[model samples]
Structure formats: C-alpha cells, structure tokens
Target: MKAREAVSRVLPATIACLVACAKPQGGGPPRVEIRPSDCAIPSQPLLRGIHSIVAERAMSCAVLDQGQVACWGVQDLGRLGDGFEVKRRDLPTRVPGLQGVVAVTQGNDATFARMADGSVRVWGPNRGGEFGDGSPDYHIAWAPRAVAQWGTIKQIAGGIPTCAIRSDDKVVCAGRARFRRMNEDTAAPGGTPVVVPGLESAAGIAAGSGFTCALLGEGSVWCWGMADAGQLGNGGGEDQDKPVHVRSLDPAVEIDAGSDTACARLAGGGVRCWGRSFAGYGLDHPEKWLRPVEIKGTRDATQISIGDRVGCALLRDSTVACWGESSYDGQLGDGSDETRGTVAGPVACVRDAVQVSVGDNHSCALLRDGTARCWGSGTYGAVGDGTHEIRKIPVAVLDAVEPAPDAERCPPGTTFKRGKGQDDLEAVAEWCETPDGKREGMYVGRWATGQKLQQGGYVSGVRHGEWTRYYEHGEVVSKDRYEHGEPHGVWIAYSLHWRFAFASCFDHGRRVWQVSSEAEANQKRCP
Candidate 1:
C-alpha cells in the first residue's frame, strides 16, 4: 500500500524496513484487496462455515457450523476468553469450554453464550453481576463458566447485568439487572436471573448501553432502564426500573439496542429506529427522537443490528445495507470512507449473507455458504483475516487452503507439516507419504490458526477407515466410515451443540436406511 504513496524523502534502509514489516505475519497469506470491478468471494470449506456473528467495539465472535464459538480482537478485560497471556489475536481463536453454542452476545465488559441444551455460559468481568453466576461483583472470569441455575434459555442479551429469554418466552435477568420480579417497585434479583414482571411471550431481546428492550410474540416492544436519550421510547427523559411499553413502534419481529439507540425490524420487513437523532432513521445528535422513525429503502430487511450511532440490516435478497452516522473507518462496507447524512445505501463487494453484525468501527456478514466476510477497521483483529489494517471493502475471514508440494515437503514414512514454527508444530493434522510420492497413512487438514479441520486415514493411495470433520473448537461436524474410498457403515451428521442431526446406515457402499432422530438410528440396523 505504501508503494503508491509519496516517500521520496525516506532513507533506503527505512523504506526497506517499512516494506518488510508490511508482509503478513503469524502464518497469514499475502494481503490482496478486492476491487469493485472483480470482487469474488473466497472459498474456505474447512475454516469458514461461520453460522452467526456478534460484535462489540473491538471484539467479534462467530458461531461455527458445529456450534463452536471463535472470538478475536482486543483481549482486554478477559473478553477473548483465553486469559491475559496475549494483548490481542489477529485471527479467530476458539473459546475454550464453549460447545454447542447457538447464540452469543457481547457486553461492554463481558460476553455470554446460550448453549443448545438451553443452558448459558459467560466470561469476562463480573462487574455489576453481568456473569449472572451470583458471584462477587468484582470477579473477573478468565475462562467460560455456567450461569445461575435457570430454566431453558433460548437467547441471551449482553449488557451490564445481562438478560435472557427462556423457552417459555419469559424474560429473566441477572447481575445488576434491575427489573422488578414481583411488582413495579420490587427490584430484580441480583446475582441470579429474576423474572421481569409484565414481560411474557417474549421472542427476542436487546440490551442497550444502559437499557434493555424486548420483542414480544405479538410484535410489540417493551423497554426499561435509563432513557435519557429516548431509549425508553416513551417520549420522556426519565429512567425506568421496570418494563415499560414503548410507543409509536410498528409491530417488530426483531430488535437491537446500542449506545443510546435502538432499532426494530417491522413485521413487513421494514426498519424503524428511535433515540439520539435530530431527524430521519437515527443520528448521534443530542436531540433524542422519543419515537421510532422508519428508514427508507430498508423495507426488505430481514435482520437488523446497530452499534454506537451506526446500524446495518441484512436484506431479503441476501445483501446488506447500512445508515446512521458516517461510514467512518469503512464500517459501512460501501467501498469508501465517504461520510453520509441520513441516506441509506447497500454494502458493496459481498453477497449471499444470512446475517450481518455491526460493531462500532467494523461489520461482519455470515454468508449462505457458511463462510464469512468482514470490513472496516481491522484493529484488534475484528476483521478476522489475521491482519490489523483498515479495509474499505469486504474481505474474507478465512485464508485459502492448499496442499504442500509432495516432492520437497512430504518425506516418506514420516510425519510431515507445512512449517517448523510453533503454531505449525501444534497442528493436529499431519500426514506421511509413500516412497513414490503418494500420500499414505493419516491425513488431516488444518486452518492457518492451527485448528484441526478434518481427519481421515488412508491405506497406500486409497482412502480407508473412519473420517471425521471438526469445527475450530474441536467439535465433530460429521463422522463416517469408508472402505476403499467408498462409503460404508454408519454415517452421522451433528448440528449445533453436537445434537444428533442426521444418520444413515450403509453396507459395502450401499445405503440401507437414513434417520433423523437418535431413537430410529438405534432401532434400525444395516443388513
């Protein structure tokens, strides 16, 4: 990038140092910026496959297809969940102890995950009881741990004193969460998740800077907590300790709350937001709009997410659009740093997205093919491509995978790897080659981050034995047995949280039966 800049006054050694330092570090591939004319989506069948993503200011987290969570960015306050050994990670690192995760939420100082079994896990500071574990408020979590005993939780909303929605559509909050459990004046239970009075049939929840909002089954919205910037949506500057009805909001199917701002995706696929804005969908100005205002051109939004004074929506046609504040630091992913007023526009150079998450200075989109792309500031590795640079356009979250040259890299009758570095040495995948330069014995593939992707065994030059694919967190994706490169025996596929998904029995490369539930697989036998 510096090659195009005017540096005639620089010394030769200094210039060389600048050029050398710009090279990819930590086993990352060479940087290549995608241009608008020929932007192509990169394929990453092994390392990508991110199902959903959640982001805060400098940190971002995504759920892999196997229900494992990978997080990166600033590791401050133990938010990265790998402890304080490193200041930051420029690549996605698995969050230890988290498996079968279906949802994730990031608070200002902590993070939360809801498991497939309807339980919840949390990490980071317990400041204000955000962990919901009933621990000391000053406790700082160095690893993931279970939350307070509660009912089956469907979702978790991150904030000071996080909140959750149970399978019964009842809302309960933990930590410094202040909703009344009994009456309007009764305070919410601290250190445990307490039910929020008057909130039932809740479908989704959003935790804001100092407030919270919920989307009910009937499409109505309710909010509580600090409302100085019209966060309560009641046209008042007063604070609320109990659930309060929000006015003028169209029946919404989804809701998101950010610093002094909140948004909702209407039943008809339109987007409306309220809070700090002089006019239009929303803005960062002091005058707070107490009522929701519709943003034009977002009538096709299927999902809505907002950050500090910024917002983005995943549209029905698999595209993403952004508005509010400026596209500062390229967070809007529109191919430029052009500042905007209230006009909304589509994000360029990426498509087929199922979900989009907006952070303060960056955004990430989970594509339909199970891969992901991120844009804007790469500081703290929020971009997840093993870099710390600003990107105006969308970039792949995974590095490309390729095989090593057999003649030079693979040694006969010995374990072979890509490199001798520390990260490479720990790679779970290694293989051996026959004297004639054909792969033999164990075969496994790993991502650049040194996580096992897939593993299988081979006899001579043909595939044999059991083969298994894994997520970044080491959860099994699929398991199957093969004989002489043909499918044989039982083959099984697991979904989020390692839950039994699909199973099929085969005999000598022939299908016998397939089942969706574990009971059926147990009763049927391949003949």
Candidate 2:
C-alpha cells in the first residue's frame, strides 16, 4: 500500500496498526541490555504475573496477579510503604501490612491501597490530613492504617490531594483544603475523608497537584479545584470548588489528571487534553488550554496518563506514544532527552505494553508478559531499576511479589483506628445529657476509643432532638435533627476538616431538599 493512499484511507483513524493485529502481550524474550553502574543487580528473580501499576510524585506501586502489593522509589516520608526500618529501595519491595489489595496508588508523600473488601488503607505522611482517619495528633502513618469505615471503594488516585471513587459512584476526597468542602465553619485540617459534594455517578477519579477530575458513568468529565493554568477545562480561568463540565468532550473512556493538566480518552479512541501546553497534544498555545483539544495524528488511545510536564498514551496496537517536556529527562522513552514538540508521536523500543503509568519525571509500562519497564528520571530510585541514573531507553524493573493470600480475615495489627465505631451504644463511655446537663434516661454516647457511638437525646432508647457523629479528632463529621425518633429538620455531613460536605432538610424522615453547603443553603433560603 502506498503511504499517501494508506493515510488518506483512514482519515480520522490517525494511528496505523503496523501489524494486522497487535501481537498479544507477553511473548518476546527479555531484551538484552547493559546495566548501569549506579544500580545493583537484584539477588532475587523478577516476580511474574503482574496485574496493575500506579505512580505518584516520585514513587511507583503495583498489584501482583495474586493480589499482593509492591512499591519502590524515593524512601523519604515512607513513600515506599516498606516500613520505617528500611528507608529506601532501589528495586520493588513488598509493602508490609497490605494484602488482598485490588488497587494501589501513590502521592507526593503517601501510598494507598483498595483491598478486596472495598476498604481503603493509607500510609506515609499525614500532612494536610491526607490519611483520612481523623486523628488530631498523628503526623505520619509509618504503617498502613484502615481509612475508618470506607468500603465498596473501586478506584483511588493521589496527588497534592488524594481522592477515591466508591462502587456506588460517589466521589470522596481527603487532604488539601484548597478544594474545601463548600462551607460550614473553618477549613478543617484534613484529618478525615469527606464526600466531594455534588459529584455522583462517577466511574473514575484522578487528582492533580491542586485539582481533581472525575469521569462520569455516561462518559462525560467534570473537574474542580485550581484552574489558573486552565487545568479545569471549563473554558475559563477560574478555580472551581465544585466540578465543572469539560466543554464539548464526552463519551470519555478514561481520564487522567496531572500537575496543572488533564487528559481524556474518548469512546472513539481519540485523545483530548487541556491545561498546561507542555503535554504536547498540539494546541497552539504553549502556556495553557482552557478547553479540550485533539492531539493531531493520534488514534486508538485506550489509555492516557499525564505527569509533571509530560504525557503518554497507550494505543490499542500495543505501542505507546508520548510527547511534551522531554528535554532534560528522557521520560518519553523515545531514546533521547529532547522535547517532542506539540504533537504526540510513537516511542521507540517499547511494544506489547498492556498498561502504562506516568509520574512526575518518569514513566513505566507493564508488558503483556507480566514484566514491567521504566524510563526517565531515576532520582531516589523512582525508576525501580535499582539505579540513580536516567534511562533514555526502557529498562526492566525488578520483578517482585508478596506473600500469597491466606484466607478472608481482618487486617491484623491495631496501633490506632481512626473513624471506626459501631452504630450501637453498647460500649457507651458517656451518655448524652439534656441541655440543662442532666443525664437523659436513654441517650447515645461515646465508645472507649473516643469515637462517638451515638450522640443525641434519646427517650425509651429512641433517638430524639439534635444528634451528631464525631470523628476521632473530636470534630463533628455529621449532624442531624431528630424529633420523636424520626429524622426532621436539617442534616449535614462534614469532611475530615469539619467543613460542610452537604446538607439536607428532612421532614418526618423524608428528605425534602439538599444543598452542598451552608452558603448554598443560604442562597436557596433553606431554613
């Protein structure tokens, strides 16, 4: 076929499949390559049968086929989650205290895992309250801790702020008060997780350094938080505390949020990106993109990931394409430490990649054979190749695995439990007293762990009057009014920071109206 004719025949399908069918994953022999002197060869064999991979600021975490978790990268602040005793790892190491993990993610200073039970666990620094456990004096979770009572969680993403999506499609986020829960009182330090009000029916969620974007079940996208660089994709340079729809882009199959930028893969296999122009998706401006723009000459994008100043796309043909900001670090995996301009093109020497993840200054691809390869900045061993040297070409990661699954059981160990309590008042430490300070005949109370089992006036063991649920930090996580054992008046939910997540008015146990915040309630004249 003539090259010109071939190009003309597939006008809209910019990607040309070099082979009739992209070869299935995991067939080729490991490519022979020289080892860098800075990296020490691993003593163990590479673990096979990998499943998924994710990266954060300068670390990477992966889930094995048998549901174990492994991680590597800068060891500061417990980013690797290997424990406090071991500070750094140049190759993949099993993250202690995690098992039956279905999904894993990393942030600038933390790591997260979604276990099979739908619960989420967090480790590393709790600065800005990213831990979501609602502890007041805790600074770091050197060991992973269960995130209170969350369950049915499907997806997790980390960044400046961290976020996750529940199986029910509701979005919850912790850390970073910039996207403060609309309004209640003061911005609470992120000591717990709270629902991102106004977001529902979401399929996936991604967090950037300061912003967040969610892909809805119907293929539309919504973004909130910082937009000074047009990262919100709402065609305006205004920060959105609530999700704003990305203009014109729809039927999005997947979405990724990066530092000051975001990208989405459409149903038809085209990819559109908005925000920082360094993504090289071919928008005219080199500074910001206020709306989604197509990367010229790209198609069949099954997945797209964005990083600090780079972006990569995994096409259906098993090959990868990358563009943007490769001048100093060869993160593009294209055999050169040079920029690829505003257009996305193929990366050389990598094929049969089943999945790919991009971090701040590096990139990784998981091949069909269950092996992983990484390239670019190796600072602090972010490359997972046991090296501090930059890799312009793809290099193998130490294949590593964790212990096999035992049986269904609770995660052992309990130094602290943040946001965990029973609904009943069986272990009441103190009962609720009336306004006059008289102990009520029957009332809710606190547990020995300081978690409020129930907090409300009760008569005949039935709830009445004002009620509240307190997180471990002594902040009211939720509150509502009750009358004669029936829900009545206004009800409010707060994030870990004690900011209003949402509020609703109820009458005789029936919800009458709801608002995202106190300001929104005031605007609507909700009494």
Candidate 3:
C-alpha cells in the first residue's frame, strides 16, 4: 500500500487496540473514548501487531545502536537520511545500505552520520551544501557513500550548515556562508561545501544556527558564518566567511552553538558565552560580547549545549544550570515563565546527568542510569511521552515496546499535556506551575501596553482600579478613583509625598477631562 494509505488504514485500529488493551492493574478497564467521530477506526486483527512511536516535535532525530543508525522526522528536505525525500515518517526508520554507524548529527533539514570505519554519509535537506556532497539541491542518499576527499573523519556537526573534522586535523564546511557574506560583495547561495581557511590542525568542530566554530590543538578557537548576531564570537558585527580566531577565548576544550549564540567550556571547568543576549544566551551587558565572558561563579562545567533561545551547562557535580528565554514552557527550568537575561540558578532534575541535548523549543537530559527526562514545548510530542503536552518540569520518555495483552492503564493524576496545536489553556497553565506555589503569580498570555482598561477589562494579576496608570518601567504608576475597580470620578496623581502631578476625570475608566494645569499636563506627558 502507498505510505499515506497505509497510515490511514493502520493508525485508527492501532490506536483502538492499544487503548483497549490498556487496563488499570487491580481494577476494571477505565472508560476509553475516541472522539471527532469521523476519524475513528475499529480495531482489526492485523492492527494488534502494529505499534506507535511518539516524539515531541518531528524535527530530525537519530539513534545509534550496535554500530547501526536509524532516523526520523521532517523529511521534506530529505532530512531523514533515508536516501529519498519521499515524505515524513513518524517512526524511526533505518537508512538503507547504512551499517557500522557510530554517531549521527542533524541540521534543521539535513542529516549526517559517521561509520565505525571513519567514513561519513550525509542526506536530507541540501538547500545549502549542508550534505557536503558538493550539490545545491536536496539529495537523498539511501545508502552510505564514501566522502573520497575527506578521510579518517573523527567528528562532525550540523546547523543551517554542516562541518566536519578529519582525523588529520583539517576542517571543512558546507552551506550558506552567512559570516563570509558579510564581507564579500556577492551573495553566496547555500549549496557546495567549502574549506575553512587558516586552520590546518583543528581537533574539533561545532556548528550553530548559522555559524560554525572549531577547536585547535593549541587550545584556541576559530569560527565563521552568520555573525550578524555575533555568533562568530569575533567581538565584532562583521561576518567572517573564512575562519578567524575568536577573541578572549582561551584554554577551550569544547564548543556548542544555538540559533544565534555559542558557548565554550574552558579547561578549568568554567563556561563562557557569546552572541545574542535577547534571551540571555549571551553574556549580561549592554554591548554584545565579542570575547568570551566566563559564566559568573560556575566552575564545574563539564558539558554544554545551546538551544534556540536557551543554553544549558552540565557541571562536574552532575547538576545542570540553564538560562535564556524561559518564557516558552519553562524550558530553562527556572521554575518560572519569566525571561531571564542571564544564567540564573541551577536546576535539580536528576543526579548524575551524563549527557544532554538542546532542541529548538525543548531540552533533554540523560541520566547515567539510562533514563531520559525532557522539558519545554510538547506541541509536537517533542517530550516523547506518548502525548502532545507542554511540560514545565521534566517528564520521562518510556521506550517504545509492543503492548501486552493486559497492559496497565494510566495512573491517577495522570493527564496528557495537550499538544501546542491543540487548544487547552487550563492544561497548559497547570503544567507551567511548580508543585510548591513558586510560579503561582506568573501568567503566560498576551497584553497590550498603553491601552485603557475597559469596563470588561481583563487582568491576570491584581488590579485595584479601572483607570490604573503605569510607569514606563512596567510598574503601577498610580490608581485612579474607583468603584469596585471601575472608574467613578476625578482622579489625581502625585509625584512625591504631597506634590500633585496630574488630575483627570473619568467615566468608567474612559478619560473625560484633564485639568488645565502645568503640573498635571507635565505628568500626563511624562508619566
């Protein structure tokens, strides 16, 4: 059967069978309801053999096991590394003719894998030469093809572009040269890989959203690509197509990149960051840091991973600390939705966190004991817990296995955090709160500044009057006369203790008259 037909014919029955087989241990089966009526399918005998694999968002993911690799998600650009841009496959599918695979890396729309023999295979989104096959068009490599020019490949990284280092300590990259374009007179299309100049003996490489960096044997760093956001770490806004030394970075051991920033781990077990600070991913300051700024007071950093808007560091003590945009589902793990402009406090998700990976909207931490925990946006099953639920706290992802004839049902207090595409505000809010009342006052919604509160004005927090004035700093400037939080009469404002600044008459929060006085007019103009 065709892929779509096969999915349509198989999905309903598989869901029903799985639902029916799941019964609470020590009790009768709980109520199971399949809704939307039209999409329902009856259980069939053949469906019993099928199983479903759940993921958070279908980006690009790969798993390496026993020298073999399997990948899935968004293959429109051939990112699945399956040798063809057929379509998206929701489940993990093995790449044809690939074996002895040891490691795999994914880009926004491309994929690359390395073999035990030190050979590399690339496939999927080739819009830029991210595939390193010297082609501009997306090429699906169904089988492992030897990169004849690159030998003894030791490490590889991917982003909007792709880069890899050979065992002999040479570096190469492919994709749009965002940093290089900043200096060149011509627009360079992303396709065709290029050699990064000035680094003849590099030991490692890391790629960001639009840039790439490398670590040399001498403990220095070089980077290139989109520096518009200062991702190149050169302490300047100019983009560098060729590799240039990153200023103020020393004793560097490892590096990682985000959508618009990069982080490096020093030999002393400390961490430093450069690039966009809008989400606090960069160092705290008014000016963009071109040089590395040591993360204040952190001295045990062992590993680091950069996300689209957040960056996380793993300490030698096995503790994890994250900062940067914590607004979207608390991906920063600060126990609040407030956007942190710097590395806040460390989080206590698990002990002995041996590995970590940061996605665009979520993060994953792997325990030394083989258990994995994830947090952030679950709109696309990115949390991989069998449901589309946004989780402010970490949730466990159960390994996929065939359902038993009598499986246990979901436990009490267990509720699926509805996916992002699904509308369920209550569920989303509940997940954003900490068990202890820490995040109670926070609300994740929209607001319009400088707008008058109407009769039916909505406020997430406390509001004492209908015509409340606010300072430019988001603080409550003053409260006007009110009757049950609705404006009733003339209101006056004062700057200091007895110094009247402004006066205004209002009818139910709508301004009606302003006193013709200099002080009142000045307050209205400034406040």
Q: Which candidate, 1 or 2, would have the higher lDDT against the true structure?
A: 1
Model 3 lDDT per residue over 333-446, tens place: 534565544543454344556556666777766554444456677653555454456666555544332221111111123321211111211111111222332221211111
TM-scores, all models, native as reference: 0.67, 0.66, 0.59
Displacement of residue 116 (Cα, Å) in model 3 is: 1.0
In order of listing, the candidates' clash counts read 3, 5, 19
- The model with the greatest lDDT is 1
Give lDDT tens digits, candidate 1, residues 198-306.
8889888888777888889888999888888888888788988877888666577888877778888888767788777623242444367687877766888887788
Per-residue lDDT of 224-332 in model 2, one digit per residue for the tens? 8888989899889988788889977778888887778888888877778888887444454457878888874357777777777878888888888776778777886
Candidate 2: where is the Cα deviation over 4 Å? Answer: 1-44, 85-87, 136-138, 181-189, 279-285, 399-527
Assess candidate 2 and give its lDDT: 0.60
Please give the CA lDDT of all the candidate structures: 0.61, 0.60, 0.50
Candidate 1 — worst ten consecutive residues by lDDT sum?
1-10
